[model samples]
Target: MDRLGDTYRWKSENVSTAEVAETLGHFSGIHEANVYGVQVPGHEGRAGCAALSLDDGARKDFDWKGLAAFAYQKLPRYAVPVFVRVLGTEVGSAASHNNKQDKVKFGAEGIDPGMKGKKVVGGEGDEVWWIPPKGIGM
Candidate 1:
């Protein structure tokens, strides 16, 4: 079974995916947001990750740092997503049979970049964005 459910532990804190998703949904350009936790090698617990579906015309104008800043204001530091997966479309890329996000699949994929990640979705639009510790300056 998938270790990650509605919540996951990170840095001795249990983060609520629903809360983070709600925070992300309010962002300007995101049409939808799927939040989950991925087990990071060498870490005691999982790290938060979000798979985003962008709104029309927002893809070209998406601001990464802006998103980071927005998240910083809206969420707790431990609750903020450490990784982001920009899904290709809002329709069928990562949806489950019930038309919701397939967290099981995303959880399995984790945060591997390069060819490994590309192989999971089989699409060129799946871009992985990382927020290294204190990398965003905000």
Candidate 2:
């Protein structure tokens, strides 16, 4: 098993979680982002997943496609997140001391379409969105 750390391999390319998170932070409605790799069945490397906290005014009608476009524009093809977890404004377990983000829990909860939304994000209003292989334009 590969150790989870500063970078992870996906689609034969090394992906930097910090870099992806920074790219996501630049998007208009995203207030916070936590990027990490999660295991995918039958895949050789982990897939990127981003957990997001939105701005107060942007939650209801947040532009998902716009964010996707931003990510595609700013990051390499391999680094674009395959799964997006919406945490609303609730910090929950995504952060800890000194406001540093933690990716363990989120990483464990891979983008399983079978899992209920609230169970993975820990909030009734939270959501999990994912793009299947070749599903999205990315």
Candidate 3:
């Protein structure tokens, strides 16, 4: 049996990072996607967030709304990532020594723009992008 703790809960629903990552991976613009649970101030539980690496030149044309819509359609409401971070050119920067995606740093960073300058193991000077909760702008 699967334990709830193994899967983080958001809005009273269990969220599987691997499942979300797999769904996000289907998008052509996303070269790589890393999913994790992130603490949101005043929220009952951690919110879902995705760290994405865009394909070459895709940033110029990346569609945030489309991605949001896709996520909404493919995942449960609670599983849809509440935030997204766009990485810089070096996409593998967030990977572990074995090339596996690492979420510890990202989870700690949350969605604060103030955390921008902080450095991750292999991710120095990487850019981060996210949609504010208001959904008015990116």
Candidate 4:
């Protein structure tokens, strides 16, 4: 996991999701942008290539393709994120030393106006999707 952690550190320090999306948006002029990765089932190793979001980053109004292509281009074949989980609202459990802990059982479940496109990012019960590269254009 050292390499994975290294990559994460590099990404967090040198490139960010928003920055990547913004760059993709500037070049593509698309409405939505995001990057995700899929973890291999039964494997504790690194995740597979990322799944890009092709939607505008706006809630209730977005282009999911924009998110997809941006990720496809910036990430090597393997480092792309796997999920396009939308956070209806950002929550913070605790932040210390500039690091924030994950908030368990967080989502739009039972919460109105927050379930649309809701996805669990990382956890035991997280659902994985295999989105075909049908519409995203590089």
Highest lDDT scorer? 1
User: What are the Cα lDDT values of the candidates?
Assistant: 0.80, 0.76, 0.75, 0.36
Per-model TM against the reference: 0.84, 0.80, 0.81, 0.41
Q: Predictions ranked by lDDT, top down?
A: 1, 2, 3, 4
Best by TM-score: 1
lDDT tens per residue, model 4, 11-81: 33333343444455454424333332223446444332222223345545554565566556765434455
The Cα RMSD of model 1 versus the native structure comes to: 2.8
RMSD of 4: 8.7
Where does candidate 2 stray beyond 4 Å?
Answer: 1-3, 91-93, 113-125, 132-138
**Candidate 2 backbone collisions, by pair:** none
Give residue 121's error in model 3 in angstroms: 4.8
Scored against the true structure, residue 130 in model 4 reaches a CA lDDT of 40
Q: Write the per-residue lDDT of candidate 2 for residues 1-138, one digit (tens) a residue.
A: 444555778999999998999889999988888888988899899989888988887988988877887777788888998898888545445565556676766676667645534244454456788754444564
lDDT of 3 by residue, 10-116 (tens): 99888888899899999879998888888888989888888898899998998877887778778877788888887774446666677767677777777777775
RMSD of each: 2.8, 3.5, 3.3, 8.7
Better of 2 and 4 by TM-score: 2
lDDT of 4 at 44: 49
Number of the candidate with higher lDDT, 2 or 3? 2
Ranking the candidates on TM-score from highest down gives 1, 3, 2, 4
